[model samples]
Target: MSPPRVLIVDDNLMNLELVSFLLQAADIDVSAASNADAALRAIAEVAPDLILMDIQLPDIDGLTLTRQIKADPRTRATPVVALTAYAMKGDEARMLEAGCDGYIAKPIDVTSFASRVKAYLARRAASSSS
Candidate 1:
């Protein structure tokens, strides 16, 4: 099987590049969008196995984007994990409520980021099968 394709959406150039580097090193297919408009476009162009979304974006926030992605029939089944530095009370629940499949707090644990991404991909595969 081909490696799972993932989309990483964030406004920070450094964060975006770092995440891309991490995923690519793990042999995962990775794509990125720096803002909501670009992200929506990318989603329409090719459906990703999972999305790593930064909650605080320059345009629409990640939560709103997650809801929009979930609402679209073509992309509704795609899993989204909010990748954010906003580690606050109730953040995870809020992201879930916004239609995120999972949450990964940032600054991401560099040592475990790849493993976490792998875990989410595994979950997506399992869930899609059954």
Candidate 2:
């Protein structure tokens, strides 16, 4: 089987570089988008195993983009995890309602970020096949 592929959509260059580097270190294929429009285009080009969506995007927010992604049949089964700093109450629930498969708070824990991503990918794979 091939290594899992991930799409990370974040406007901050720092966050994008960090996340992509970490995922690549784990042998995962990584793609990126700096804004919502780019993210949508990226999804149409390739169906990734998982998506790391930054909630505060430049154009359409990550929550809105995630909903669009889930609504589209071609990308519905791909797991999306909200990567946000909004750890406030109800934020996670809101992201979930918007169609995120998981949540990862910002200022990510470098040591565990890759593992958490892997967990979500595994979860998505299991759910789809079962």
Candidate 3:
């Protein structure tokens, strides 16, 4: 089977690079976008299996975009994970409410980041198969 494709949507250049580098090192396909518009375009072009979204986007917020994705029949089944610095109380719940399938806090632990992403993909595959 082919490697899973992931789209990381974040306004920060460094964050995008770090996540992409880490995932790519694990032999995953990584695509990135700096803002919501680019992210939407990337989504259409990449047809990513998963999306890692940053809440504090320059354009539309990630949660709103997630809502849009969930509302769309074509993209609704693809898992969307919130990857943000918002670790406050109820933040994860709020993200989940907005349609995120998972949540990962920001300033990610580099050592375990790849494994965590792979776990999400594995879980998604398992769930879809069953």
Candidate 4:
């Protein structure tokens, strides 16, 4: 089977590199975008299986971008996992409300990031198959 494609969107180059490296190490095909505009463009081109989106972007916020992506029929079903530094009360719920499939706080645990991503991909695959 082909490796799942993942789009990692973050304003921080370091964060983008880190997430891309981790996902690549797990044998996933990763595309990195430094801003919302690039992210949207990449999504249109690559049609990634999943998106690791950072909340704070230079142009548009991740929540708004998530809503936009989900609102479009073509990309609506693609799972989006919010990657944020904000781990305060209700943040996760807010992200979910914005249409994120899952939430991962920043200062990511590289050891378990791949596993968490895989878990979501597995569920997505199962659901699609069914």
Top candidate when judged by lDDT against the true structure: 3
Collision pairs in model 2:
none
Q: Give candidate 2's total backbone clashes.
A: 0
lDDT value, residue 112 of candidate 4:
100
With candidate 3 superimposed using the best TM-score fit, by how many Å does residue 129's alpha carbon deviate from the native?
1.6
Candidate 2 residues lying further than 4 Å off, grouped into runs, are: none
Per-residue CA lDDT of model 1 for 4-109, tens digit only, reads 8999999999998999999999999998999999999988886889999999999889999999999999999999999977779988889999999888988888
Q: What local lDDT does model 2 show for residue 101?
A: 85
Residue-level lDDT of model 3, residues 28-101, one tens digit each, is 99999988899889999999989999999988999999999899999999999999899899998999999999
lDDT tens digits, residue span 1-130, model 4: 9999999989898898888888889999999898878999999999999999999998989999999999999999999999999989999899999999989998999999999999988988998899
Q: Candidate 4: misplaced stretches above 4 Å?
A: none
Query: What's the distance in Å from true for residue 74, model 1?
Result: 1.0
Tens-digit lDDT track of model 2 for 39-73: 98998887788999999998889999999999999
Off by more than 4 A, model 3: none
So what's the TM-score on candidate 4? 0.97
